[model samples]
Target: MATESAAPSPFEDQVLAHLRNAEAAYHAEQRERARELDELEATRAALAESQTHARLLTAELDAQRWNAERERQRVECLKQAMREIHGALFHGDVYTLILRACLTISGATRGIYVTCTRPDGPLRVRAHIDIPAIQGAAPPPMVAQLCRDVLAKNDTIVCSEADTAARLSGDEPQGLRFRNCVAAPVVLLANLDGVVLAADKMDGEFDDRDIEALLSVGDQATVAVRNRHLERELQTAYVHTVTMLADAVEAKDPYTHGHCEMASRYARLVASRLGLSEHDQALVCYSALLHDVGKIGVSDGVLNKPGPLLPEEVELMRAHVRVGYDLLNHVPALRDVADVVLRHHEHYDGGGYPDGMRGEDIPMPARIVSVADAYCAMITRRSYKDAYPEAAARAELRRCAGTQFDPVVVDAFLAILDTPEALDGDSDDFAECGLLPGFEAMRAQASPV
Candidate 1:
């Protein structure tokens, strides 16, 4: 047994050596794999960090772009406001011009021009888009009150989404109806007259950007309102001057007094019934009152001819429309009205005057005035024609519908006349119906003779 054991010692030693080598190789491979795993983990960590940094840089860039766009919008809004202020201060009919500008700039679905009755009285909506729901209808009480409050405080009130929701939850009336609003006091120095409130943003609530935009607009509006007030005062004085000039023109012809005055009153009435916008109604009133202004250019002999004129005289009489238009074109205040005056004689059938425009091609304001002028001429006393009774006037208006006058305008005029009170013997009948101011009184003041 001892001899057999001694013979296998070398073999055993060799096997032990091989076993140690295999274990060493296994341990070396394990260490290499561990090193590779550590390297992979480091790579993964670096990759994650790079992605995070990239995401951060991308977010920063997007933020900068958003801020730049917002700044550009603010700058553009400021420029527009400056332009509007310039227009308001320089232009005639600044009130109407400003209203139109506000509508365009604010993106309002509708806007109303309002004036306070007194320093502290409630705001009365004067002009709007001419929707039947708004015309002559009382504004919501809270809106009136809010306007008063803003005027009193001289502070701008911006109703954002949260504020709107909160206000709606309260007893306040108007804010609940409007989804969003921005109101700024229309103050001139220390005098607080009223506030221009823009309501109902089509997108959502009024944000800071919207409030800033409105404030910019308010700055322009303040200037416009002050300018308009001054203009109205000046125009009132000019109206007196024009009245005298018109009276002198009428002095050469007695029958012209009732014709011009009654026609003006009737024109205003028809304008109201036809749903002409407040701006158009004012323009029509001005144009109708001055419709015979062209007659001022006519010689006394032709103007007071008292009977049928010669062909040349009739031709000269027909030139008055253009003459009136030209005269008013020089006066910036009456430029828009002058256009109506020039087209007042245009017929619905395209047979009537300077341009001979037909159907809807004729300006609606002119179409309204045409019916009013004809109706007043038919109803009022004339030198060569007997004044027709109201019934005869109605019949004549119906006869000329869609031919000499727009059928729709004729219908509106007839509807206004259908109320017997509107056609009563009193010359102020239309005024009593609240469609216009006192016709007889204005006629008395404005008549040439």
Candidate 2:
């Protein structure tokens, strides 16, 4: 132990050093290989991440394309709907076209077109899709609130789940548990006219595109409504003009100043008794008032003549119907009334008239007017005749029911005479005239027939 365990010789020491160098070199190489392996593993990980990122980008781009295509299709559908609205005949038809476009763009399950002159009052459900709306009944609380809110804000509003749940008022209509809503308000004549609102989007909550679509459709619908309003105004003006013309003819003849006015009441009463529709009733009444308007075109000599006229003079007198027809034929609202005016002189037996139309050949409105006019003329004092007694007028009306007048019209007129108002013509109740019919009287239909 004491002798330093034998000091190695130089050659042996050199050999040991060489062996130690080799072992050291081997360990260093192993460390280098470990470092290389770590770098390879890191590179593989980076490559995987890049591939994943690429896939994500590709997927996002694809999704965007799909959405773009959907939007394109939606816009096209809306465009087509807009074109269809141009052909809409009624306000109801216009509303329907707007709703269909909304459904197409928003994926809504149901749609409604509501209007109210006041925001606080009950809303009128003019048109609907898939909702059994009772038109005049109370609207669903949710829908009512949506419309009210839209009106108050004067802007479009979108109600998602939470909003619908909180803002919902009383019991909604069955199956009206809306998860989402979109309300587009339409302003007209400087007032809040109404709202076009949709509910229950099927796919998801309403987004920007849905709101935009609704606004576009609302604007289109507003145009249609405004057009209808203008048409109504024009129609009213035309009717007023007709009234003036009737008055002018009456002014020319002292005895006929109130003749046309009285005859109209009789015609309307007869129409009502016969169960004619409001439009038909209005037709008969208007025809009666304007039946003699064409006489304005006749020479004053013929109109003031106290005796029977020659053949040529009579021909001139019969031309009054043609004149009246020409005047009204150009106005679309009065076209139907014109038919009555032109044919009112036709006899029930085909013996009297310029057209020789008989029996059912004459329009029913004209038939009614013929009976009312004859009776009224019989009872009134004319330039050429004396006023007939009430009994005599009644007898005369009965005498010509089948030959000169529509028998059914004569019977209906006599039956409703429980009071003397039919002959008095004193009441100013022009209530049944429907000067601006609710799509019935003075209807301004623009759709292509």
Candidate 3:
């Protein structure tokens, strides 16, 4: 009966079913835990890879920043050097200044400036710095020859070693020593003018970096040198043009050869005696030279008249000053000259021609030129009359000083005439007319008026 009852207990059967269900739930929970563990492992691997990628990105960013910074520094240095070069060029001889600047910029052990005599000729040293006393006194012939070759070819040469051994192997001069050298031609357009040589890099042997720096310096030097050369040429040309213009005006009057320039010199001398500033002296000189340029517009008969001018002719002659002023007033380079030309005939005591400018109303340059021109005319032999003696000319200037001539300018002229050299008329003529040679020829081919 107990065995039968054990098979038939509902509550016990329920308990067994509950235990089996619990075991199944436990197995399911264990499976879920294993899946969660696998997911966690995968997440850790992804995080590690992401961190590595972030590190790599940060390293790449740092490298880019470093490169950018270096480039900025290099550009700034080049700009500074260029500015210095520009300043030096304006202040002094361009070649000398550039040579000094290059030495300072590159910090080379030594530097040399060599210019060729001709396009293909040998090179001669113009300037140099930082060498043995003996070497400086006499540069090696091989170095000079090499400079010529480089300039002729318009090529650059960089040598890492400049010792006697290296030089001897190549047939260069002996007893020479240099660790590095760079040579470049001063080329403008396709023509080579000279060469620049730098030796012994202070930091290390010549490399691309060193070469690039030298090249930059060389380029600036070349430009500055060329500009200075051009400026000198322009100054020469300007002087020539001024002389020619004066001559052309003088040629209109048969009795007035070289008179304009002579009068200008006299005017400058007078102004100098007055303790005038250099600028004012120059103005006086320029004005005197151009005082009669308006006569170019006058008729030949009137300009070269051998007799007294008629009242009408005198009026026509007076118009020339205004005409000259008009002709030159619009030109920026000649405005000052035009102003003096207009007022030079004005009287100092309020009675004058054109605008009737009086006293200080007339420019100082005009006043000064008026006194010089009158003095020169008094002492100069004319077709109408012989020249006056020094005493008579001095008396005439003094007589007209307060009325016709500027008082200060007349005083200066008197002082200039007091010198022993002004006693002889011929001496006065020479003093007034001595101009730089070839002035006319130079003027004929000048660029413009």
Q: Is candidate 2 or candidate 3 better by lDDT?
A: 2
Off by over 4 Å in 3: 1-97, 107-119, 122-184, 197-211, 221-241, 270-282, 330-332, 416-449
Ranking by TM-score: 2, 3, 1
Clashing pairs in 3: none
Residue 68 of model 1: what lDDT? Answer: 80
What lDDT score is found at residue 402 in candidate 3? 86
- What's the lDDT of the predicted structure labeled candidate 3? 0.68
Off by over 4 Å in 1: 1-225, 418-449
Count backbone clashes in candidate 2: 0
Model 2, runs deviating above 4 Å: 9-22, 89-92, 116-126, 131-141, 187-192, 220-222, 242-289, 295-319, 326-336, 347-350, 357-449
| Residue pairs clashing, model 1 | 247-448
Please, what are the lDDT tens digits per residue for candidate 3 over residues 1-449? 35544464899889999999999999999999999999998999999999999999999999789656745665665676666555543234456565665555455668777766465665566677664223223346656655756765777787766342455445443324567777777654445667777777677656565556656666666566665566556545655656666677878886777566567767777777777765566667777777887887899888778888999999988988988888666544466678888999999987888887789888888898888788778778776688899799889999998898887888777777667544433423322433322222333344244
Instruction: Return the top candidate by TM-score.
Output: 2
The lDDT ranking, best first, is: 2, 3, 1
**TM-score for each predicted model, relative to the true structure:** 0.49, 0.66, 0.59
The alpha-carbon lDDT assigned to residue 284 of candidate 1 equals: 76
